[model samples]
Target: MEKKAAEKRVQELHTLLNQYNYEYHVLDHPSVPDAEYDQLMRELTDIEAQYPDLVSPESPTQRVGGEILSAFNKVEHKIPMLSLGNAFNEADLRDFDRKVKQAVGDDVEYVCELKIDGLAISLHYENGLFIQGSTRGDGTIGEDITANLKTIRSIPLRISQPMTIEVRGEAYMPKKSFEKLNQQKEENGEEPFANPRNAAAGSLRQLDPRIAASRNLDIFLYAIGDFSETGATTHHDGLNLLEKLGFKVNKEREKCTSIEEVIQYVQKWVEKRPHLPYEIDGIVIKVNSFVQQSELGTTAKSPRWAIAYKFPAEEVVTRLRDIELSVGRTGVITPTALLDPVRVAGTKVQRASLHNEDLIREKDIKIGDHVVIKKAGDIIPEVVNVLVERRTGEEKEFLMPTHCPECESELVRLEGEVALRCINPKCPAQIREGLIHFVSRNAMNIDGLGEKVISQLFSHELIHDVADIYRLQKDQLLALERMGEKSVTNLLAAIEKSKSNSLEKLLFGLGIRHVGAKAAKTLAQQFGNMNELKKATREELTAIQDIGEKMADSIVSYFENEEAISLIQELEAAGLNMNYTGPMPVQVESISSSLAGKVVVLTGKLEQLTRNEAKEQLEALGATVTGSVSKKTDLVIAGADAGSKLTKATELGIEVWDEEKMLEEFNR
Candidate 1:
């Protein structure tokens, strides 16, 4: 009788958990407090443990939480997670409404919610417990980020029901959090994150849950999938049911009885969005009835039942006081518009990148022209379209300089490329930028060696070329600002450590034209070492996949240069690795597997394993680990809340495996 009673309790817990999951994931309405849900989950887990026979496959306690994944395994989505059709203006919205009306009749209701400006994620829940989370990568596959998702405070560890469900939502960093993070990064002498969206995206992609946790990410579940068993006749009812669960739904969501109401809501939010703590790019409008949505169906890339109404870009008219030319590390000469101070997109706009001479000519922008400027993606300030009416005859046509701005060397525009480049290897500006790039995170990854330190080194004549970095003495470094004995030692140690890094890093650090990180890695791996690469002719170089003739010529020319030869010899003499060393070995077999081909995402905090170690282990095993969870993900290794990825995965019916099971498979 006791056994029977316990079994009955488990079943009850399962049902409750599924219902709550549906409420939270599908409908985005979580009714219960997180604590109560957690308590119930603990009880269910205890009951299941006491009577192992009573535990079912769909139990809420069986999520992927026990062991942290060494890395996420990729899963290909059966169905592509297509992008939404956008409604940029009132006319577009009206057209969308008309289409919906034509398909589902004029009586269709609408649900409007903020279109979050972070990463789009999918979550999968089975039997009411959170499982896998993924990014919307190419809509077909994405990295599994189950571990990172588990760290979100608002995401529930378990659900209230035993039904399998999938939910989708936007994962975003609040504006306040973004600001604080940027402040801290600046204080630490790190480059500040460009925008809230980028910050959120970057934070979510981190392999370590601890790093993700530090970012303070948040989410709002919006849609439900696999809802046939729930008897939710309409989207509105499904949302109501979701509210009864334990998910965090956006409070600003509204139900509109008609398209007019939806438009009104969208309009209202466009004005009211500035007051919100998070960045919202637009409003998502969807048909509220499941029947109506089915009737409306979908297009190649978007659902006919829903449309995103993008807010008009914020534009402000400002005077172009002067045009400045700046040379980047890559030797690309960019034109800058120094604007009269104006605020656009909640940020002060003082300068904007003109991109190149072609853009300047295309826009016909002059030094004294009154222009309208706006921030694209609310991050990069750009001159959209010139206010031609405001242009005065005094506005002079700006011409690019025929010579290098710094060294006055004759500039040459390479064929097939737009911008003119200064080929002088010793140009002071280019050298400074090159040094900074060499020590950048993606390059040598030298800690404590930043732009300021490089500048100081250059000023003191302690370093001129890239090889000079290897020759820094302790006494010389100690004389620099903020440098002490310990700091100097640490810097030296870092420099020494970087010397042994794979040839790919060294190749990237060289700042060769058109050779990005991936290209450098490919070149290193294909050639085996710098010597082989330098010996290869242009024809041999271009034979590799993805390397074009232009890239080949550039690489050949760079290697042929006497300065480059000297630098390589000096670096080789300093004990820097000049050849490819294959991939890093797996620290333990438990992290390597056939799962290497799969993309894996880690969401929540792990009781064991650092995120970096896990990523390394996975990579060594031949798997590609990505930060975002998308449809292409093979599995979501979830822990805790697991946020949007968990919801999206469930919606897509993707399989989610627990950490213990993953470990067992790996061991097997």
Candidate 2:
């Protein structure tokens, strides 16, 4: 009887979890608190662990993402997730209505919703339980992010009823959360995320679900998969059903009888979007009836049954006062435009990026010029154009500096690069910026070592180079204002922990020019150690896949410098890892010989190998795998419903292969 009761309990837990998953992933309505959902998941996990036989493939406990995906595995979507036609104005919306009328005749109602500014995701539910969640990558295939999706509190662990359904929604970061995250990043001396959308995408793509959970992401369900399960027959009714099932459907959604009403809704939100805590790029209008939608059909890329009405780009005019030059840790002089205080989107704008001397010349911007500024995507403040008519004759033409503003040394513009750089490694400005970059999140990721701390350290003559950071004593740190014993201890601990970071992170932290995180990882993997990387000739470095001529030159030049070599020796003396452990396996020599210097794209699922595993194999074989499929792509590994990429590849006559062929050729 006890065994029977245990089995029943397991079954009940599974049912409850499925209901929650459906409500959250499909409907976007989470009835329970985050803590409560977490508790349930824990309980389910415990049960599954206790009685391993009771665990099934559809269990909610299975979604906690495991194994750092070296790459994303492709999934062939059963239905193509097409894009929506865009409506820029009310007239465009009316034209859409006219088209709908022409196709389906009169009597078509509309479901109007806030078009969330986020990455689109599709959730597959089986028997009213959440099974899998994937990105809408090219519509036909997507990366499986089931674990990351599960971490979102708004996603349910289970559904209320037994039914198979597919739901689509927008996963976004709240504006408040974005601000908080950026603040934390800034305080830690890390580069702020570009915007909430990018933040959300970055968070969701993390290998660790715990990291994603801490990001405070939210979602809003917009549409049902096919509309056959919900018998109500209209888009509005389907939304209601989704809400009833515990999904977080958009409360702002409305049933509009006409396009005029939809336009009013759009207008209302355009003015009010900033007031909300989340970002919405536009409004989506869908034909109410499934029958009407079927009649409207779809275009090659988008659907005719629905249209997205985009809000006009938010712009505000401000005055450009003066251009200020700031030197980075790498001795790059960045020009910033000091602006008269003006309100752009929701934030007060006081500065804008000049980009480079080229941009200044292109815009013909001058000191004391009245400029029209706008936040690009409501995030970055940039001077769009100068109010040339308003410019007085007294305005002075800003001249590019021949010397470094900080170090007073000769500035050099490298071949094919725009920014004029200060080659002096010992420049105070460069030291401060380089130190900040060394402790940045993508690099060593040292917490509590901020700009103020670095500045104070420099001012007091406590440290000179990156290696000096490790030599900092607690008593010395305590001498600075606001640095208590505990804070000093924490800072020291973080710095010490950073020493154990992988070779890739160290490579990035070194501040090599044109070498980003991806490039650093690639270089680390290829060379196997910093010592090997330092000894590599320009010819040897350029021979590596994705290592362009410019990058090779930069690497060679950096290593050739006595200062750089001495710094590396000092860092090695500080007990940092100077060798690689070969995280990714080396590919067969035969495969490496053939695919050398070629770009390949992996699409769709491989039955035998995980996407990450495949990526490692390919990378080891001297092939570069890019995320997107382009005309430059030499080969595409097509696996089931390869989508537009496959179509384009065929059109371009790019070589295509299946998983079986890939496995056979690569000997995986």
lDDT of 2 by residue, 1-668 (tens): 36677689878877776766665655657777778778888887777777788877557675555655555567667887766767888889999999899988878899899988788899888887788888876566678888788877677656556878888889999888887998877664446777677788889888777778788898987778878757868888888888776678888899899877888898899889878878787899999988888878886557889988877667877778899999987777889999999866545578999989999999999999989887754667889899899976989988879998877999999888889999996788988888878888778888788777777888898988789999998889988877778888989999999888889888898889988777888899898889889889999988987788989999999999998999899999999987665476355455535666578888864433446667766776778887668777999987643667778888999999876566545542
Note the Cα lDDT for every prediction shown.
0.77, 0.80
**RMSD in order of candidates:** 12.3, 8.4
Off by over 4 Å in 2: 1-107, 121-166, 202-217, 256-268, 295-304, 341-348, 377-379, 389-403, 410-420, 445-457, 473-497, 500-504, 513-526, 542-554, 580-668
For candidate 2, the per-residue lDDT at 329 reads 75
Cα deviation at 665, candidate 1, in Å, is 30
Against the true structure, what is each candidate's TM-score?
A: 0.69, 0.70
Reference-based TM-score, model 1: 0.69
Q: After superposition, how far is residue 668 of candidate 2 from its true place, in Å?
A: 19
Candidate 1, residue 581: lDDT: 84
Give candidate 1 misplaced runs (Cα > 4 Å): 1-70, 75-82, 124-129, 159-164, 319-321, 330-332, 340-348, 356-370, 376-379, 385-423, 440-462, 470-505, 514-522, 538-553, 581-668
* Candidate 2 TM-score over all chains jointly: 0.70
